[model samples]
Target: MSKDLLTVSLDVYLGADPVLCEIVPNSSCGDVDSEDLEKQPKRSRKASVKSEDISRSSASSRARHDPVSVLVKGGVAVDPSLEEPLRSNAHVLSELDTVWHVMLNQTNISMNSNKFYLIQLLKSDTEDKYWVFIRWGRVGYRGQTSLTSYENKLEEAKKFFCDKFLAKTCNEWSNRSSFEAHPGKYAIVATKFEVPTKKEEVCKPEPEVLQVSRLDWRVQSLIGLITNLQKMEEDVLQLEYDASKFPLGNLTREQIEEGYRCLKDIENAINTKKFDAVFRDSVNRYYTCIPHDFGFRAPPLIKTQEDFKKELLLLETLKDIEVSYKVLRSARESKDNRAHVDRFYDKMHCQLHPLERDNDEFKVSMVSMYLSLGHGLTHMFSMEIVNVYSVYKEDEYRRFKGSIGNSMLLWHGSRVSNFYNILSHGLRIAPPEVPLTGYMFGKGVYFADVATKSGNYCHPSNGKCALLMLSEVALGESQVLYDANYTADKLEQGKNSTIGMGRKDGVRVPLGPLEDCGGDGGRYSLLYNEYIVYDVTQIRSRYVVEFNFRL
Candidate 1:
């Protein structure tokens, strides 16, 4: 990392009396030796280095020939080549020079200006002569070179010139005497400032391009405008800070306000108009002011680039949606819209099929649903073992341990007519609709009818109904059967007793309830307990089942 830098003002030196050392032609300047420079008081590291190098070399070189005329301006070496008139390539001043480059209003000192004054001593590299260089111009500008050589009384002549320059440049001072009268009129203020690295040092990443199809032109223009405005804001802030550090730059608060005004105008333009209408050439001039490479790899610009990319993607998606709508409208109006509309619809359906298909089906909690209804497995069937033999090459049939004929029998399924409707209506507990045609021989007919009829039984309050059927085939059957011996006694009693006759079994039994019954015997069991279903649906069935059994 680099060391910290300090900013100083040029006015601070104006009050100091010019030192007039007699200049002897062909004679060297009695600059301080290295030992003396190291002893001198200093604040900047670069300044100390310059002073040390010059002091160390001047003494020994001076002893060999005529001592060189050395002048230390702001603790830096006086290289005439580095100053104006010679086009010096050397890094003229140390990075630590505390020169306050100022811009002065030639007509008024109180007002801000861009005109600055600079003075330097130069030694001729080709000719054995010395010259003084003085200039007044804008900062970062090389207006013209003005040179004056001092052959005799050089130091005195240079002092007179310096005094005259300060008097003319500063509007407050009419002459050298007035400046001396009020030395404190101009105060020196110091502040922190950063010197940006050279452009070559900064890494530049590849520029990102947004490929928005329909609105590419509009989006690109808006992005370009936003980018330029953002850069202008940064530049203005830098100039403001620079002005504070160097009073001569004449960077005032007014200039900063102007920059903010420029940014606001661009923002207003973006918000008020459609992006397509923001293509004014005058506003486009901001593009020229921005750096081409933009240092996209830099931290500040990285976030800026990402924001632009996101905006581009959003615009692109919006454009796609709009185009899709247009295409749909055109398809509706055209007669031969099969190619365009049908293909589009097909592609859309394909994309949406996964979400819509079987979405109504859900895991059926048979345990919870059955328990809520006070119903459960009526019988747990035990498996019966059967032996089989296989005939091979031998005539006699012999049973082998590995090749025994085995038969697996699945149980007959039971159907609860109204219960199926409730479960099928709620998707949370409904299983996938199963094909009942070949599920279990003739048992599937009743199961298939229940599954189809349940669709209309959906109740809104209770979400979707789930199927109470299990995934695997049931392998059990109920064992409730009517006794043949009791049937003869029931028949004899039915023929002799009247409608109100009490049964001989002790308890009085009602007879008219089943008197008009049509005998269509399939399967039946006497219910021993009452069953109850919760209020998840409107109907809360709680009644004693006359004859119910799971088979």
Candidate 2:
């Protein structure tokens, strides 16, 4: 294929609108300068490809090809010559019913493979027919496709679809809500869709709408944050790491392990006063294991402890990017690709309701405390509380408050990309395989009494937005610590939680009349008040606040 023609093919494969790239017949895709092509807009350049010329070239290039099936409107397969029937068929199936659609992803960092499989079942609107379409391949590529037709046999089609889903995911389709991932198998990826509802529109304003409009301005800000999923997705995508440097846009588990080991060695070297050859070798080893794309410029060496810490953080960020990229690829490959990220929340079974700015006493107290607590050491940066939202997870909340007491709302924050899994699975303890160097207080769900302390974990830089969650933590009987304790998870006999005593005080007033457990009676002095819970059931996510930090 010609250079220009190849670009067109890539564009089509990447889910660009084909209608915009109208191909002029009997024309050649002329050679264009590389520099000039780079300057031109992508849409403008796509129009230059000659469809007929490329089609003929592609046909001549292939050997022993199967019967070509062309997909037209309404996903109906037709012969190229019988184009007239497509219009009528599409019109008939305009309101086609979707029986089922699933997108699955399997990423084995150990094997360095990231792939996606999409299966869809659709029922004909005008006829007794069902279509089963399946597509599978490495992400960011067009991949292979198969279309099976079941004439007047909906049961057979459904069976075929379910069988395929089970074969790929090793999980029953009916029990997908409780999805379990098996070794060396695809995991069912959760996706959200905006299906049109058939409810008749009422002329009068909804009580909920009136209630929301009368909320306090601060509460309104919180409402805006929860409702604006589009903005949140954009912020998450902006938190990108360079994936193009890795093989198939995936970081292998081996690479991650090696990177962590290197960081640990450097940390030890710094403490032992061996920052010469030992530190240099560790730094070199890290760069070798984790390939970075520095282009023409020379890659910098990690010389100081601060630099070593930054590299360690980068390795962790890469892991998050790998996960977010796979989810994004699966969403893009599906038929209904609109608002894919926003729909992720629906798949996780987590609901976010905006707190009333005016009438909600809880919102008023929470916002007031959040703003007022911005004094002392935490008040260095200007804090803007963008939105406040009440989180509801039926199973977690119901199971959480069973025998727990002395609950107080505290702050938790994480990177935007991590929220995809964080909100889905709730906060999780680090597995045995993960490195312990990053977790100062060990593998547990950590929270903070001060917003800035938790907000720092969001890693906000360059004026980007970050997400923070306030959860009702049941810290019944806590063990106090001032220094790092790697084995903090091995709690003593009766302690329900661990409190890291900090130098600064949190909220002066009680956070919503909850029983206040004052700081460690000024016994130990740490930087900030850190709350760590070993059990996941001891926490109930209360509010998620999105805010921007201005330097």
Candidate 3:
């Protein structure tokens, strides 16, 4: 096997960072002078090898001078002759009707590594030339690049590309849809790349007709709170995560799974009440697995259970943020220089219809009921309903309707940054890999009867806005719990969900007309009533309410 192929397999699949080394030609492979190699920097040595390869393989004078057609910063493989700017080749590829790109990642905590490999097949617009571009390195580093040109031989370039992919991943490119990872091979990373739309083809939605004009003047002030793109953008950006720190702008599935394991270990240590050296080590390992940009300051250690709980919540938010950031990054690649939020909004799979304050009776009722539920500490944060959007998610509703029986609308809230994925995929049940300790009612989709109870989950503070979803939860047969049950997924026969009873009840009952919870009204120690459904199919998203919190 060639050294390059071996290196690709190890670096790409084994989660090892690509080592910067000189690529010696086959002729001089066995006769390397250690002293001479020591005299030159590794980069200079690689450049010289690349130059030699180009000069020896090509007859063209232009190819000899501008030897390596390396992938530049923006993932664009520019032929020096074309002299194109360092933007994406997405549009150019679209015009050629040939866009082939794949991302692969492998992160192993045991190996202490996180790595990514990006490969693309580019066809030159000016000629019948083709280039197979490969970039591989550590997750946060620019790493290395190599480009191979097939002059007027597209078939040869394609075969070479597919062969390289097989060699690295042990999976055929054509059969990628059913891709099964070999014991030690790179996992395919799914990414959404948007093709640049022509300005004429872009169909911007027409502005909504004002319903307030037809309403009484007394209710005109409520119209000001309707969500616009600008306000949504402001609220979403408040997450303030440093995407630059994460070159991929998201964590790999493997990395996220590893994070769960790390958190589970920390959770065990916390439960044991052991703040020993081993506990400290576990904390450090968690941070390493899930990197956080704490700026210049060192990350604080999780010395308390409260701190651990906060970390768990942070991990949950980070998982959702990853989805939103990935979409935003792909949006950044488009030629359109529009605001990131506008681009992100255009990429959502589900439709969001803004509800008018004056015309939408449902919105008015929801707002009134939400305010009425504020009792005790829930009333501390003065809530203002900014916008209410009817979520038209057909797929989630289809799956939810499959399960028959008692269904009631309840509240679910999350960070504003998470809305992109939540709207796209609807509410999700926690993955089996996630630690049970991360949730109070085990791994399930949680909802609240009281709007303010779920509102607290938004982590709302003064001058900031948050998002809440009123979802229709199908509780076929309920298991009412007065305390935390980590293994609540083991529902009693015929029970579809778990309802955690609280000491205090909501001012009003559930919004929709649904069957009664056939169980006795036994009280729990929880401050708020929480409903947890183990299956994602039991939840249908209804309205997304955006609200501001004031002290």
Candidate 4:
């Protein structure tokens, strides 16, 4: 099989970085020769050989000179005729040298400005479209070339760009509205080209186009901004990192802060303003800045080998995850007459409270254990098989999983609501949530888990548990109404108003201590507070559970 790729289509996924890009004949960018490419596997094998063999013998290689490497001191670039100063066909390959060359020739600025620098996700509200800044990279950009009119005809162009430049499918996400545009400080300039391959051979290139969408003006604007910002950010970061090598650590803190202020002043002077409100012309001006390396030519846009190494690690991790998913899928499909498919779940390794423990390991244990309880899979054994087959790409499935744990630990879901409100009730045990979705797994409240979401949490240890807990909540607030630290063994199962009766510490607390006083069950929001509101409409027989609060 061929190796998987770390696509530099529009943005980076899983922290993977670009090792090299080539400006080939067609609209496509063949993969780089980085070692990390070997990490992930793909369905196709020798897919690149057909193209590379012809490329090595062709005049194109002679024309571009080096095929595998470049002698760029700053950033990589191509011939004006070969590169198309307006839009460099992305087939050409170059090294970090090209970025350095741009800085050396473009500006006369020092980069050691003192100040606190930070990296933040560009919001749709930001006027900037570029997520990247390149230095010695390609000097020009591909603009709105999707030949679609202002009407819905943009679909053809959109598909073309997806296949050529982005490789993105429109209907893949639940939040289809997310791809829509917003005002931003950055600008993007890109295009998509389709170089159809002859049936017998797939190695040749034939056509090129910009990645812009023809559907709506807003879509066009968004694509443009993404391209522009990517190029610009690549350049800016290249210079910034390079400057660090010649650190003037001897400079006083005040001097550093002063330098930072000066840099901010420069930024303010760079025609920076809100863009989502305005249109067209402003975006064009932004494109002009793509090749401008801060107007300050430098010693060199420096980079360390370590940066690439980290990128390799991320790529490898992605490969591992993909492999695991495949294995799990195969096992799942092999259903037999047996009631359930069983797999080993370790216990002894987790039970030991090791002396020479680590922090990450500790975090994993706490979270894993907590999530395990949600599924009613609590005991620490070497391994055990259980009924957890419904692992697909569904939010309800995850909700079900988390609910399973809550039911195991607390008898039933604390409060019944829609999928979102239910998950929000916090039966999960994950890490922090930077975004509601699409981020590293953080501490979470589960009872809403079935391995959905763009990201997930993995234990840092070889095997460990993560703790999950909920506490009594007051249902008065709008958001989270309750949190209880109920545990196993201490959990008292209840059947209607007769809950927790006769058990040692089990006193039947009214479902709604405020509204119904000594109430029956209907709809109740048990926020993590004393004030409970119970509305009993129709009381039916269902199971209730409570947990041990022992630390």
Q: Give candidate 3 misplaced runs (Cα > 4 Å).
A: 1-244, 247-250, 274-278, 293-298, 328-347, 374-379, 507-523
Candidate 2 residue lDDT tens string, 1-551: 34433311111211121222323221232111122112211211121112211112111111111222233333222212112332123211222243276666554332334445667665444555655555543332223344455556767768878897887778998788787767556665443332323312111223221112334455444333433434333333232222211221234455566667877777777667676765665654554455432322234555565665566666655555445445544643455433434333445577777666676877756565765463336445655766667788887888795376778778888776566556666887865645565566778999887777777777757577777888888888899888888788889998888988776656623542212245554565566678999999998887777778777
Task: Give all candidate RMSDs, comma-separated.
Answer: 38.0, 14.1, 12.7, 24.7
Clash count list over all predictions: 20, 4, 0, 130
Clashing pairs in 3: none
Residue-level lDDT tens digits of model 1 in 307-386: 33322222222222223333333444354424432433322211111111134222112222222232212222211111
Number of backbone clashes in candidate 2: 4
RMSD of 3: 12.7
lDDT of 3 by residue, 1-551 (tens): 23322111111111112233433222211211122112212221221113211111111110101122233322222222221331123112332223466666554333434445566666543345555655554343333355555556767767867886786679998888787765335666553334434422222224333221433232222222221323332332233222222323335556666667878887777788876766665665565455443322335566666767766776666676566566656765566555444455556656566677679986667655755554336347766876677777778867775456888777887766566678767788777667677577788889877777777777768977677888888888899888888888888998889988776555434443212333454545576678898888888887877778887
Cα displacement (angstroms), candidate 3, residue 39, comes to 16
User: Deviation in angstroms for 466 in model 3?
Assistant: 1.6
Q: How accurate is candidate 3 locally (lDDT)?
A: 0.55
Residue-level lDDT tens digits of model 4 in 1-551: 12332221111211122223432231222212222222222222221122211101011111111122211111122212111221122222112221101111111113211111111111011121211111111121110011111122323323332332111222222232243322221112111112223322222333333232223333222222212222222323332321111111111233223323332332233334322323232222322222222211222221222322222222222222223233333433343322111210010011112112254455344333433332312212221111111112233332232211212112112211111112222222321211112111112222222111101122111222211112222222212222232221122243111121110111112211112223423233321112111211111111111112111
TM-score of each: 0.19, 0.52, 0.56, 0.18
Candidate no. 4 TM-score = 0.18
Ordered by lDDT, highest first, the candidates read 3, 2, 1, 4
